[model samples]
Target: MAVRKIEHVGVMVTDMERSIAFYRDVLGLETLGTLDHGNGTIKLAFLGSPGAGETQLELVQGYTGRLAEEGKVHHIAFTVDDLDAEIARIAKLDVTFIDPDITVLPNGARYRFFYGPDGEWLELFQPA
Candidate 1:
C-alpha cells in the first residue's frame, strides 16, 4: 500500500564506467550519480533523463561477475512512501525477503530486497 510507483530498474553490469558511458552517450540519459554500497563489494550508478521525477536506470556492478540465466536485469525497484510500513505489510505475504534488514545508502536512500513469485528480484525503496 505504501508503494507509489516503479522507481527504477536495476541492470547488472560487469563494468560501471562502460555502462555509465553507454547509458549516457548512446541512450541520451544523463549520469545522475554513483554510489558504493555499504557491503563494500558492490558499486551502483544511476542514470536517467535530465529531469526530475523521471524513472531511472541503475547500473549495478560487483554483485556477481558471472551473469545468471535470468540475464542482466537484476531487480525492479518500487518507490515507497513508508518503507517500514511496507516492510511490515509485506511480511504478512507469502513472498520471501532477500535481505533481513533495510539497507540505508550513504545518500540516505533506504531499501529492502525481496523475491517475486517466480523468484525474480524485487526491491522496496524509499529515496532520500
Candidate 2:
C-alpha cells in the first residue's frame, strides 16, 4: 500500500453559513463547492486557497451529537507565512484565542490556538 498526501480534512459544524464565513472571510480561504450526502443527511462545503489542489477544509453540517474534546480530532492547524499578521486579521473577527501569547516549540516553531465558529480548536503554525 502507498500513501501519497492528505486530500482534505472534514469538520462537522452546527451552522453552514457561519462556518463558511469563518473559514472564507476570517481565514481567507476560497470556496470550491459543496456536496450533499445521504440525501441531505450531510452537507459539505469545500474551502481552501486558490491552486491548493486537493488540500481543503471540508465543513460539514447536520450532525447534532456530542463533539470531540479540544485536544482530540477536533483540532486543525494551518501553516502561515506571517503568524502575527494572520493573528491580527483573526482578531478582527469573532474568534477566541486559547492562549494570550504565541507558543514557541523546542525546534523554534511558533503556534497559537483559537476556536472556530463551532468551538473547534484551530491553530496557526509558523515554522522556524
Candidate 3:
C-alpha cells in the first residue's frame, strides 16, 4: 500500500471549548473545521499551524472514554528542516518530553518522543 500523507492527529479531550481555546488561542493554531460524531457527545476539531496537516493537531472530545496514552504513540510524526531546533522550541513550551534525544525505531528511522497534555505520545523525526 502506498500512503500519501498523514491526515491529522486526533486528541480526545474532556472539555471542547477549553481544548479549542488552548490550541487555537494560546497555541495560535487555525481551526479548519469540526466534526460532530453524534454516536456519543464527541466532537473533532481539525486544526493546523502554518505547516498545515504536516503539523495538524486534532482535538477530539468525548471519545475513547479515556485520554490518549502517555508515551510511545501508535503513530509518530516527524517534520522539520532541523530536528534539534524544533526540539529546543518545544522544550521552551514547558512541555513534559519523554526523550529529548534521537531514538532509533525498528524501521530504522530516527525520532524523538514527547508527551501531550492529554497523555498523547508524539514522535518527531526527519526522513532519511
Question: Top model by lDDT, which number?
Answer: 1
Write model 2 residue lDDT over 22-54, tens digit each, in one string. 988888998988867545677768798978675
- Assess every candidate by TM-score: 0.93, 0.52, 0.48
lDDT of each: 0.89, 0.73, 0.63
lDDT for model 3: 0.63
Provide the lowest-lDDT 10-residue window in model 3. 67-76
Candidates 1 and 3 compared: the better one by TM-score is 1
Q: In the order shown, what is each candidate's alpha-carbon RMSD? A: 1.4, 13.6, 11.6
In the range 26-109, model 1's lDDT, one tens digit per residue, is 988988888899777899999888786568999989875677667789999999999999998989986699998999999999
- Cα lDDT tens digits, model 3, 72-123, are 1233454555566777787899977787468653334455768878766766
Better of 2 and 3 by lDDT: 2
What is candidate 3's CA lDDT for residue 113?
69
- Minimum summed lDDT over a 10-residue window in model 1 is located at 63-72
* Full-model lDDT, candidate 1: 0.89
Runs in model 1 lying further than 4 Å from the true structure: none
Model 2 Cα displacement at 14 (Å)? Answer: 0.4
